[model samples]
Target: METLANLESFVRSAEQGGFSGAARRLGLTPAAISRNVAMLERNLGIRLFHRSTRKLTLTEDGERFLTAIRDNLEGLQAAIAEAGGERREPAGVLKVSLSPTFGTDHILPLLPDFLKSYPGIQIDWQFDNRQVDLVAEGFDAAIGGGFELSPGIVSRVLAPAHIIAVASPAYVAGRTLPLDPAGLGELDGIVMRSDRTGRIRQWMMRNAAGEEMAAAPKETIVVNDPAAMCRAALLGLGVTLIAVPDVLPHLESGALIRLVPKWYADAGPISVYYASRTLLPAKTRVFIDFVADHFKRQRLAERFAGSLG
Candidate 1:
């Protein structure tokens, strides 16, 4: 009879295309993967892979066997995990990715209580602004806005990622307030250059009266990071459009003021993303519920809407 280790090695090697790649994914050495596959082939009396120095390709029998087992692989793993007591307690490392500013400002504050409640679970969190491949990179969950959802990934909207024009009180003190988007070009503009596109980003602003216009300010300073743009505004360098959540505290503290109170850009929904599975691990399941509840209890959806007068 073939063992689970042999089957897993075969499947992972087939998916990864090489023993070395499978080793990385399964946390086993290439020799172990090779040995397991060899043992399985010996047991079955058939070669499953066409082994080579350059790449590993499946044999005819291997392709058929993979088709039969691939659909059930995740379910089999879940069943094993449940039998090993994952369903009873969240006791494994939970890997998550999040944006630096939002995670620090909002999600980081909730960790104390979450950790207190689920002490058995360890958090491995990465802060980044780039869209990550959740399944390929092995992230348990991710949080941010404007992620393109691939197959087998799910997302729950946490809040509206709305952008609004903000400036330090001193910056706007001597300048005339912009009554419309067209008037914004007269003020010194602090803007962001896209790291991916290398072009200055523009904002499409909408007012409360259902009027829309493109606000492309004359750039005085260009930045790549959201936090740095806010800092530049704080130093009274120029007016900048920023996410409402990023500047909410400053606006409330009177450090930053909304230039056009009714105008905002609807970027998209800030979301919590995870792999779509019928049986979610307890750690991932609890974290999702906790974050959703936190947003609701704090009224972050409304506050971060950029509609506050």
Candidate 2:
């Protein structure tokens, strides 16, 4: 009979792609992980992984074994955690990825109350604009927009990710207001160069009646960060397209004004993403529910819709 430790070592090594990576996740030494895997292979009389200086790949039998035991392993671990009273009191390092501006302005404010409710949970949050590989990087969850959903990942829509044209009150004070998306070309446009594609992004603006027109800004001032673009617009540099959530405070305070109130670009949903597992950690499960509830309570979805006139 294979020991549970041997099975765990094998599974984690396969998922992480090497003994060293598995050791980091499981808090075991790489040699210990390797020994356990070797012992498991010896007992089963079959090789599990093809080892090399550069990489580790699973053998055919190993792949089949991993498929059969992966879900069961997670379930077993979850069950053990539950038996040890973890289900009643969720406790762990809750690692989450978030966009810097939105996470600071919105999600950070909710942490106090969450911490109060779950004293056992420790938060390890990474704030960055780039999309992250959740499984590869070992994140418990991520909150952002425009991430491609990879295999074994799931998302819950938190809000509409809507982009709208905005300009500072000073910039638009004497300029002729644009009637449609095509008129936006006349203004000096503050735009963003895509970090992933290295190109200036184009917006396809839509009206209330579902009419679509493309807006290609003049690209007078190019920026990378959304907040920086908003700041540039605030300095009366140019008109810029930005997400509603990123510019809501400015709009509300009269620092920035909407260029075309009826026009917006649908950028899809701002979502909370997590690994799709049969048995999620208690901390992760509660955190997801808490965030969703908070969004609903605050009417953030409506606020982020970019529908304000």
Candidate 3:
């Protein structure tokens, strides 16, 4: 009898044409996949793959072995699933990436309920602001706005990524409220500078009536991060434009107030993205549905829509 892990690893590596892809699909490390293949090869006393620096090629024996096992692999897996009760219960580490503040503020709260519902599934959340290569990085899913829709990747939109001007109530208490975006030039601006491009970010505010105008405020304080900009505004430094999701709690708590409430800038939709496959792994599939359900139940689509103007 052959070890199931060794057999599965060999078959998956052959099908995927690389250990990395097989590892990603199996939720194992690439080194682990390679070790399993090596073990299988040693057991059979045959070199299954002609490994190279760039890619692996199937040896003659490898091709024959694949033909022998390809049709039976799924059946074997299903049999094992039945024995282990995995068919009914999804179990695995669900690796995901998301922005730090958003993940902490929104997604982290769902963990307790998620863990209770799926005890077998472990959460491995990576908080980051940069766009990551989902497939190459082997991430099960990612949540953010402005991700480039590369091939094989699909997005499930959660909310509108609309930017609205905001300021702490203390900062605006005595200051004359900007009647229009043009009047923003009169106030000190705690503006965002793009870290990647080294450029000051700017937005043309638009209202429900379709009126548009420049929103350049006096560049009093410059920061490269959204969280920092929010902090600056909270400290009564000046008003800053920000996404509604990041500042929703403060707004509700009366710590922050919406400025130029009628005007907003469309930044795009924040979406949950994952690889598009015919049969997604059980853990990944369940997680995707769970997030979508939460977003719908919370009415986040409506609450995060700053561009409703």
Candidate 4:
């Protein structure tokens, strides 16, 4: 019986059309690949390829053998993948990056429960305001908002985020509230830089009559940090455009009021992304599954609350 390791090298070399290419793909030296294939041939008592200085061609027997080997090999690979997907005892380090505000508002608050469930998985969490290259940083996952996602990465939308225009109670005390999105031009705006480019954020709003438009002040005070912008708005600096969850506390406390209640919009989706590589490490798969289930339960609760209202 031939060892699977030797058979794998032979199949790789045949599929890659050359030993060097297969070696590169398998992260092995060309000499090592040749040795493995030679060993496979010796064990099987057959030549799998017609070799030359400039070319390597599969023999008739090699072609037929390779076809059968290919199927078996693929089956073996799928079996391994399925086995690895079982994250019941995920035990390893899981590194993740997330937006600072979202991390503080959502992820941090729910982390204790996650730790309780999977005590085997250790987390190295980093809060970042800027976009991070997960592959380069060696992060297992990332949580972010936006419709656009990086290529070669798998993404699952956690929730539909709501963006609202809000201002402090003090700012609205003597001011005329905007009944429509068009009236936003008459108010002082505090623009927060929530995106990577540091541009002043604009409000996408719709009036009670359902007329929609994007609004921003001619003169705007731009702030980089969402927390700082929230603080400024709460202190009555100006009306700010922010995600609802970030300002939910202030809304409940009567510290801030919606400037244009009818103008709230769904700010696309908040997603958790990870590399789409075929083989996922145990810890990463565990966290992804848990996070998805957690958000599903949260959405269900939200639906119940909305029904009660």
Candidate 5:
């Protein structure tokens, strides 16, 4: 197959009627243009030019080849320019993977405004708990936490993934509020078991003053999913350790209150992941920027920090 450079050079030389003129247009030396055309001719096993000192003329085969490739060449150039992030009108199906709960709570709400601003782009968002293979699965972007970074994947931290103890007001109505993490051991725990290891999940809680302790609540109810555990907590089943985003609405609405407020379990970060930082498509880049901007503008990091309580 001929390279893009060779095809471009041959077409440019044919259009200009001389290698020197093509070279000037393409910002290449005349010798470079001639070599590219020659390489392309060899690759195609046909002579495309009748070369002379004064001018370049197309051979019979060259005329047919030029006609066939002229329109296609313009399309290829447009595609290349778009791929290089030169697209003014970004329009395409943006396939993104997101954690179900977090996606619904956080990113999904921004969709109406996002779609309003970018009417050309269509969203194909998948809400799942499992970590998706971004490049292998052909995803444009993903947002959540605990994604194992593969080669070419990059993450931008949007908020602190802090697991704070929360229980519905009805559950904790008459019960004494705990002043520390260890006091959680006395409460009925709506704990989650790891689906991967089939083991009970435990956390080491930390505070802003560098204090660390175990937050092992009584294993009264066990589930495999964080969302389930969160639901149980909200239902007034028991106190559970959950990420801030999962219960931010409830916390704000006075449905659930933080227990042992000064301590939280650090679960890395909630990040927006993509294939590359510099070579991202326009739609993906803007989405990442939009999510990050909202997170910052709303001060989600500070609000999500349980240690400050």
Candidate 6:
């Protein structure tokens, strides 16, 4: 195989019309450029140039080799330029993995703006409820709810995810509302199957005395998707423990009512994680900034629910 360095030197010499000219352009001595070209010619078993003191001429073999490799050489240059140009602007493909519910609520709605702003970029998205291997999957970033993030990845706290228990007003009709966390066992509920915890999720609550506790209602329905569970609660199927943003609209519309007041569980921060911070790609950086600004301006959990109301 032809060495890239030698091929580069040979191409430069041919384009510049002489070894000294190629050397000057490449920041190498003329002797070094000549050596590179000679090495390339010997490796390829072809005499690339017919040379004299006055002028240089390409041999037939040289012309054919140049024609074949010119495009490849130019492609290499363009790639190098793009990689180095990241400091100035965003470019290239960006892969992001996220929970389907969070992506639908927060990122998907604002995606058009991101695409419009950076027309040169492309994206690959993976939306799943299961934890994914971000690095192995080549994901530039991941957006997830809850506090614990996989080690070895960089993460940022983008927003607080509020966990609350809510049910349709019809479900509460003719029934005394659960006055205490212990009373929750008498009510029916839709629960999320937590992949991380490997069990059916229990509603988290705080009592009037400020004690945090988990309540698993005796009458419960298990489901995976938060949006689906919220919808079920709206239809008076059962109480659903969901993110505040997911149920905001129902609360306003008087369709769903918050079961616990301010004592609802605080699930901690919603985080946006990426592979590394040392050198973030342009597309990933732009999306991160956009997400941070979006949650700050709209308060994700509130705006969507407010819309329903």
Top of the candidates by TM-score: 2
Error of 2 at 126 (Å): 1.7
The number of clashing residue pairs in each candidate reads: 0, 0, 0, 0, 0, 3
lDDT of each: 0.89, 0.89, 0.88, 0.74, 0.85, 0.74
lDDT of 1 by residue, 1-309 (tens): 677889989998997788876775555788999999999999999999998889999999999989998778777877787788634767678889999999999998999999999999898999998999886677889999999999769999999999999899999997889987778898999999999899999999997777899887789999999999999999999899999989889999999999878889999999999978766778899999999999999999999998655
| Candidate 4 structure quality by residue, lDDT tens digits, 77-191 | 6677687666457777788898888778777887888889889988799998766766545678898776356664778877656777778888888888877656777887777
Compared with the true structure, what per-residue lDDT tens digits does model 5 show for residues 41-77? 8888999989777788999999999999988987886
Each candidate structure's TM-score, on Cα atoms with residue i matched to residue i, is: 0.87, 0.88, 0.82, 0.70, 0.74, 0.66
Among residues 3 or more apart in sequence or in different chains, the pairs in candidate 4 whose N, CA or C atoms overlap within 3 Å are none
Model 5 deviation from the true structure expressed as Cα RMSD, one decimal place: 12.3
Off by over 4 Å in 6: 1-88, 195-198, 207-209, 301-309
* Distance from true location, Cα of 239 in model 3, Å: 0.7
The candidates, ranked best first by TM-score, are: 2, 1, 3, 5, 4, 6
| Candidate 3 overall lDDT versus native | 0.88
Q: Rank the candidates by lDDT, best first.
A: 2, 1, 3, 5, 4, 6
On TM-score, who's better, 1 or 5? 1
The segments of candidate 2 whose C-alpha lies over 4 angstroms from its true place after superposition are 1-5, 21-32, 42-47, 59-64, 81-88, 307-309
RMSD of 4: 6.7
**How many times do residue backbones clash in model 3?**
0
Q: Give every collision pair in model 5.
A: none
Model 1, position 271, has a per-residue lDDT of 98
